[model samples]
Target: MSERRRRIGDGLAVLAGARPDVLAAAPGARQRFVALGGVLLSTGALAAVSAAFAVGMALGVWWPLAVLVGLGWGAVVVNLDRMLLVGMAHDSSLKRNLVMAVPRVGLALVLGVVVATPLTLQVFSKEIDTEIVAMQAEAADAHRVALESDSRFAGLPDLRERIATQEAVVASGGVADPGLAVVRAGVTEKQAAYDRAVTLQRELDAKAQCELDGTCGTGDAGTGEAYLQARAAADAQTAVVTAARAELDTAVAAVAAAEGRSAALAGSSLDADRAELTRLTAELDRQQAAFDVENEGSGGILLRLEALDRLGGRNMTLAAAQFMLSLLFMCVEVLPVLMKLLLNFSPPTAYDRLVQLRDSGDVELEEMAQESRRTVAQAKEELLVLAERERVDRQKEAILARRRAALAEVAARTEAARAQPEAPAAEEPAEAPRQLWDTGPIRELARSAAVRTVRSVRRRPADRTPTTV
Candidate 1:
């Protein structure tokens, strides 16, 4: 257990960007760094939770995938925090420290805000969900209204009414044409006239019979003038009834003909009308289905965020709570950087001094190494220059020796030519003697030139050599 605890401590110290060896030398700093590491760990865990919630709620990804992403996000946060902590060396200069801390704080601030949003949304999940439902309903209503108002579907209502009217007409064995209705009305009027005429004739006949029997009409025993008059009237009404019946029959036939024509027209167009109606109905249903789908899937991150904003706006307490919660999470994210910066502001600790000493020792050693290399390089350059100078001197010496040998050989040849000169007057000419005399000074001039060349070589400075340290 002790061993495990020790290992855990070491791991946390490393996570805090602290050297365990350095901390070992200064036990006082170990707890401080370990606590920082614990803060980092907690921050990472919070970040992971936030990421998981964001992925699940905002992106609507599968839970397992969200968890994987969360783990990756947590690792990234941990690494970024470690870098922030490690980058801040314990400097005594306040200006330098501030300069270094500003960017880091800014970065951490942005990260804190990003990490806090999802958690904040989760905190108000219930309210957000309720708001999302309301929003979806509102959107659906708006879409429905827009669809209704759209010109493409403007004929839907008319189509539906027409379909209903036509269906009723077909079911009731009625005609939809105005001419058919007029013909039927005429038939009804003619039938009423014929029935009236027939009724009159019956009443007159009854009266006549009554008169003959002396039952109720006039008390006359035999057929009198009144009875004869009633009989005549009854005969006239019979003719009227027959003519009225004939007109009624003609009107009825016209109605039947009109009905037949209407039926034929309705039959001819019914399929086409129904097809149009069905198409319009399907279009309306498709629009409704699309709206339903959109409304159902409307619970996204943006909507949730908007809901949270709305809630915050409506309730001061909620807004304050949201602000405070966000601040709390952000502070957690920024804690490591702030802690390191504050520690920098204070006097350097033992660990800082030890690290400084180690770094200074390294710098000194590196300087010594650089100096040694420069010295070695300078020495090598000087040796090469000296060797070049020696080669030049040797070459000058060889040239001098060769000049001396050539001078000596020329003198010997001159002496030999002079000793053999008695036979040369006829063969060689007087100009040869003058040329030999001119050659006498050549050796002296060559000797002087060789002396000057040797002097120039000796005087040239070895400029390629570097200065010694």
Candidate 2:
């Protein structure tokens, strides 16, 4: 059991290092760390790609660019997943581990959000659809108001009124201008005069035919006189009728010419122009009514976001449900990171404790070896300093000994010279009287002796070595 526990500890440590040896040395550890990491990365990648795809679809991006973006997002998420695990394994102490956990927790939260968004959107699809319909209607009404606000649109009613007035005039057989109405009146009077003239001509022709047929004629005079008189009266009446008919015909022609001009002007004029304006206005209204804002690409999701914000007062039950569902999904996404965090605080099982003890023993042994190496290195450095100090002291002692020997040799020479110089005094030269405390003569003698000794030493041969101390 102890051996097995030791093995588990070694495997865990190795896996934490993410070394290739994990495959050969600890297959179980390899599966636990490497395979699990792969699973996490795959899950994160799928979630990220799905999220990006949904956003692209909502925004109406081209399919190829959307796919490329999804792939990029997936790669980012995979890297984050790997980094999250690495960070989790980096610290052992509670405080330091918690500090390291911050970035991982934030990453997990973002992943959760990415994964949960689509689900939330799917769940609330019906509500979004209804909202879109209402928004479309509102947009249509707004468009209509905007179109009506235009100056040209505002003048449509006036155009319609003018059209109606013109229709009424046309129905009553009136021309476009008041002057054409006067011309029509003249035509009517000329028509009446022409009818009277035609009636007189018809009666004259019938009476003259009866008299010629001998049906009913008074024998007031011979046939010639009656005929002449009848003829003259008939001729005079015909002249009057001809003159009136000619005048009527001329009037009728004048009225016809005026009517023709009026009709021609009406065909090319006001009514046609008004009809065109009416047609154009109606077309504008139709276009305005058909306009729908909610149907625009990506507009639906924006509206959904609005609905979510307003859900609290609008639909409490649905809002609660959505919140709970999102939270549940988010927890699922963060479960692995949470597990790693909890593992840090958990007490080790018996086997794990045994493995930890084994690892601790090894660590202690390694620390002892390092301490021994440091001690040896420090002792070696101290020995080198001691050797250098001893060499300097030896050199200094040799120099002082040489100086002392030179002083002793000079004293010996001075003693010998004093013993051999007694016959050399210049007739006992008189000495100056000295004060009781004075030592002037003794100082003079010492100075002369020192100068003589220095000269003698300079004259000595280099081969004459001074005695050593």
Candidate 3:
């Protein structure tokens, strides 16, 4: 005899508020729960800190304790959850199970506090004096000390000796010291020397010209006027020479600028092409990373595509499976209703038309039951296939969406890079480059590793068989 009837009796015991377990609480189970609760709270906190530490390390920090704590925390917390679940199964009443599920939630909240507390502590504990500010202060102090150093004072004598030599040169020429005279005159003393030289040179030249050509009317000209004309001519010649020097400098600057531009134009397009390739490669990498997140069994692009096709075929069969499962769950939900209908629609006291139909010595009624059984069997087979297909498809779509989003992000970044300036040539100076132009070694290293992995994977002939471990 099937125990469906006995099972119903047990359900009634539960509903009637009778003791459902042998003990009010299982002693062994209770101790396990307490231990799990404590460990989860403690270890979970430590794990968060460890994970944060690991992230910092990856970013070039060297906090060893974080890695140790994170590994320990993760291991302890995982085992703690498992142990807690085992203890929870001791009494196994649906009502009690529901209440105990809440502990895990509480444990999670407490762990959050653990992670947050350390960060708060770090923020508060930061050094009051910054290294940059301290360094600047030290620099200023050093500069002041340099001004007062014996080394600085020693150099002053050499400077004074040069000044004395200049003074002697001025005195020998019967001229005042230009530097001192300028201060007294409230004008540059060099102007007086220039004026005298111009006047004298003109006077000499004018007299000599008249003597040479025999036509200059100023041969017997006064020395003062002759000096003035000579000075003007000399000033004009000096101005011409200065202008020529300035033009030469300007030409040199223009030539250097043009050479730089020409060299840059020749190399820029190659850098741009390299940058674009880098962006495309990055996008492909991101897509693959996203695909991995779903952790589906899809092994490659070709495998994923094939799985997608299989999913569609599986979906076509789902409609039939759904019909069967719907029927089965409905049967469970309304089993009481069915039992009531069978036992108490009040079996006819006298055989009525309906009773006559069911009792007709009826071979046809028996055949109808057999047909119903066949239908149920076919429905079940279809349902199983549908269930398996759906599971596969759902995993595939999740993986696909992740990969798609990753790919899109990579593409956007790469396309944006096109508008950005290319990294300068290796021969170029570092100060001249922008951040976007720096691809950073990490991106390159990851790419090379990926390439090597793919090449290794390709070297072996692929097995068409599904992976089994």
Candidate 4:
């Protein structure tokens, strides 16, 4: 086999053969699938949005797309994040299958109803409105055409000719409108009669409605009966007017009797009517006063409650104090000394140079000062171990917190790193192979890869780089 193929085959064998059962039992497959799915989904999502935006731009309805276009990429990212979380959370055989199936089924159910119902309703409404408007328009057009075909309009030319003849007839004969004169006189007399009848009818109804119903609400039970009586009286008046329609009534005795009786009742009943009116007015005034008193009492109570709340927390003062002594004990700060002794050498939560210096056994003032400036170098192997551990922590945290929080172990290690002194810088340059670590181990492997590349390039140096600028 060629060298490249040999390397690839060896790598594959190493990956495929190592701890196969552990990977099958754990989240290895699901986690790898999640990463793969994220890449595929991201590409598809970007393509979908780009296509949608292009179509929207072509349609000239692009303004409505401002929000969807802007947020689509973020939505894809959120889904990718969700996929990773789920893959980690439910990576086992049955659990992964069950969990994934549920969301798909639920989404199908929701979308089936949500999308279909509104679309169906919209279509039905549009069809109904279109049919209704078309029917109304057709009816209107037919009605307009029938009115245009009326015989009255066809005879308008002859009518216009007679108008001049009528004008001449009026000019030749002075005051020639006997019909108008008779109509005017009849109208005036009928108007007077109508006014008198209306006045009498209103008086009867007002007396019944106001008195029997006790100012409209107190004794309103009799309102229906009184309204029936009013209707009967109106019917009787209508019958009388119908009989007299053609001026055919010549009953002078009946009319005289009605007038005489009406006058007699008005005169003798005046005192009774005045007393009834006085009684009704007094009852109305009493109800009004009672309602006003109740309303006013409730309003006064509300105002008092509002005043109490206003005074409850209207004024307050807040005070705070903090005391810190920088040098309460120069020999040994009182707090630390007491804490170290009482707590069995437990360290304080903050940075403290004095304790570190004391622990380092460099109590001399000059040496302690120099020690404060000293820094230590962490071995390259240690950093490599920590970085590998960090990657593993990140992968686990991605599962537990829905990729939301850093793992607890990662935080602890980061805090440990923060507590330690910084790494010292190098004072001299040196050539070194760089496969495994700067500290050692795989320098020979890096040197081998470098030699192979150099030899390959020298064999065909002209083809090593593209000719284009």
Candidate 5:
């Protein structure tokens, strides 16, 4: 258990960018860094879960892929947080610390919002789902209304009404032809006349029988002139009734023929109108079906977010709860950076002091190394200059020695020539002075001096041998 605890502490220290060697020296700093690491780890874990939920809901990706994406996101978040923590070194100057921390805090705030939103959405998933359903219905209705208002389907309602009117006409057996209506009216009047005639005839026949039997009406016992007149009228009414019935049959046939003709004419137009109406209705239905398919199940992250917003607006309690929850999550995300900043503002901890000390020590060590290199380079340059001066001085002394020897040799040769007899002019020739000037010893000395000077110049300071006088 102690070993495991130590390992865990080491891991956390590494996570917080703390040096284990340094941390071991200062045990006081270990717990602080360990706590910071815990915050970082929790933040990363939350980020992963939030990212997974967001990816799954927003992109509708496969679960395994979403999990992979979540893991990657968590790693990135951990790296970012680690960078933030590591970059904020303990500083003595409050102003410098603030300057360094401001941008990091701002970045953390942005990250916090990004990480919190998805978790917040997940928290209110049920409410968001319900709101999303309502929103989808509203969107569908709006789209339907927009489609109906489109010019292509603008005449749809008129077509339906026109088709209905035409259908009614066709079903009613005929068009409203004036000639047919007149014929029907005439047939009706003739039938009425025939009915009246038949009734009169029956009454007349009854009255005649009653008079012959001497029952009532004329008070006569036998058939008289009145009875005979009534009988004749009865006979005339029977003829009228028969004629009326014949005319009624003819009119009925004419009306039937007219109805057939009218029905045929109207049926053709109704069929054309009905076909157009069906085509228009089918087109509208097709468009509506496509619209439905396009917008079906549109519960993406954006939609859910919008739903959450709407839910918040409709209920103050929910709004407050959502706000509080979001704030809580964001606070968690921002805690590490804020913690680092607060620690920076406070009196330096032993860990912070050690980190500062180690960092300063590293700086001092680098500076010392650079200065040493510069001093070495300067010494080397000075040594080369001194060696060059020595070589030049030696060459000058060798040249002087050669010059003195040549002068001495010329003086000796002149004195010897004077002591000896004057040589024959022909034997000496006119080139004697030139020969004296270009003597062997002097040339040898010049040659030796030249060789020695070349050797001396070519040799390094360490390799140089002393010149012979």
Candidate 6:
């Protein structure tokens, strides 16, 4: 079991290799960093794939691009997690750790949500499918209602009824028409009257002929008169028959007109309307069939998500379950970062102490280096000051040497003038007559002699020159 655990640790380390600084500062730091890093990276990989899958499902045609973006987001998340871990491990103070962790925590939370959503959806797949089916049914019902509400279909029942009424009128002949029925009755009555008038006229004419021939006892003058009367009545009947015939002709013509009007009205516009209705009904059927076909297939992941969203609001128990599940997955994704943060609370390990020691030593060495640089700079400044002073002293010495040379030349000239050896005694006594013994003149002479002696002593320290004129 120990060997197994060791192997697992080594494997994790491979996944999360250590940085050089981390390896150098702490003994066995490589494996620790690797193991922690591996957890982060592995979680990140899961997150990446899950995000790709979820986005691909939601975006449909843009799924490929969404998947790529999700992958990049996952990489960013993993990198942030790694940085957080590093900060947590390195920072010694709680306040510092919290300050450093703010951005990382925010990023981890965002990534955790991104990673958890897909897994949660998978967990509730059955419920989502059921919801999707129900949504499809509702959609189908709405489609049907929309089709039925169309003006063309809506008027179909009225159109059919109107067409049926028109057809019945045509089938029953023109008798159902009020105008045609009235015309037919008028014709029938006029024709019967004309026929009766003809019969009466024929009978009257026969009786008159019998009376004129006197072929019987009853055929007398009275009979003849009666026959005449009968003739007049027959004539009247003839006029009546003529009038009835004209009326009957007019009535027959009216009947023909009525029949023509009825026939013209029966089918002129109704057939066209019915034909249009047939076409529209066919079109509606086709549309409905197409709609049914479209709705038959299973909807995509976006539909499932929409269903889940609805479910979350409607069902509290389900919402709680989903939330808990998502939280669980989020924790899984951020486990590595959490581990590092938790470790910050624990007492420092040997490796932690070592790193701290190494850091302190580095700081001390840096301070020492800075001090050495300062000392060197100070020494250099002092050396420059001393060199400047020496140069100034040398310049003063050069000036003094030139002064001494000038004074020596003056002394040599004075000695030459004094060593001229008493050649002009008369001339000198005449010049010496001008108050040579007066106190002011004597003091001036002494001052000149003292100045000469001082110069002579400096030039040739062996001779003490006498004070002479």
Q: Give the per-residue lDDT digits (tens) of candidate 5, residues 1-469.
A: 9999999988987998899878887998888889999999999998999999999998889999998999889889989999999999877788998899989988888888999999999999999888887887888899878877899878888878766665665687764544477878977998888788788888988988887877876878787987787788788888988998898888888888887787777678877877887887788888888877766657888888889988888899999999999889889989999998888878878777787788899999999999999999999877877776777687778776776776687678766656665566667565534443445565676667667766765767567553322
Q: What lDDT score belongs to each candidate, Candidate 1 first?
A: 0.84, 0.64, 0.45, 0.41, 0.82, 0.71
- The TM-score between candidate 2 and the true structure equals 0.46
Candidate closest to the true structure, highest lDDT: 1
Among these predicted structures, which one has the highest TM-score? 1
Residue-wise lDDT of candidate 1 within 297-353, one digit each (tens)? 877778888988888889999999999999999999999999999999999899999
TM-scores of the candidates in the order shown: 0.74, 0.46, 0.18, 0.17, 0.69, 0.50
**Which runs of model 5 end up more than 4 angstroms from their true locations?**
92-94, 175-261, 383-469
Residue clash pairs of candidate 4: none
Candidate 2: tens digits of C-alpha lDDT, residues 1-469: 9999656654443433344442454344444554455456555666666666576647768877867777777667666666676666533588977887777888888888877776677677777667756766666777778777776587676777666655544554445445576776776787787778778767766666556655546534335655666666677778878887787778777766775665555545666767678686878866763564334433545666565656545888988988898887677667667766776667644434444566688899999999999999999877866675566456556655654565576556556555553444456647643443343444455556556555544553344433221
Ranking by TM-score: 1, 5, 6, 2, 3, 4
Candidate 2 segments whose C-alpha is farther than 4 A from its true place: 1-42, 45-49, 52-56, 59-72, 90-92, 173-269, 275-300, 307-313, 347-469
Q: After superposition, how far is residue 429 of candidate 1 from its true place, in Å?
A: 15
- Runs in model 4 deviating more than 4 A are 1-92, 115-125, 128-251, 256-469
Model 1 alpha-carbon drift over 4 Å, by segment: 58-62, 90-102, 123-134, 137-141, 176-248, 283-298, 307-323, 356-365, 410-469
Against the true structure, what is every candidate's RMSD?
5.5, 14.0, 46.1, 40.0, 8.4, 15.3
Clashing pairs in 1: none
Q: Pick the winner on lDDT between candidates 2 and 3.
A: 2
In model 3, pairs of residues that clash are 198-231, 199-227, 202-230
Give the local distance difference test score of model 1: 0.84
TM-score of model number 4? 0.17
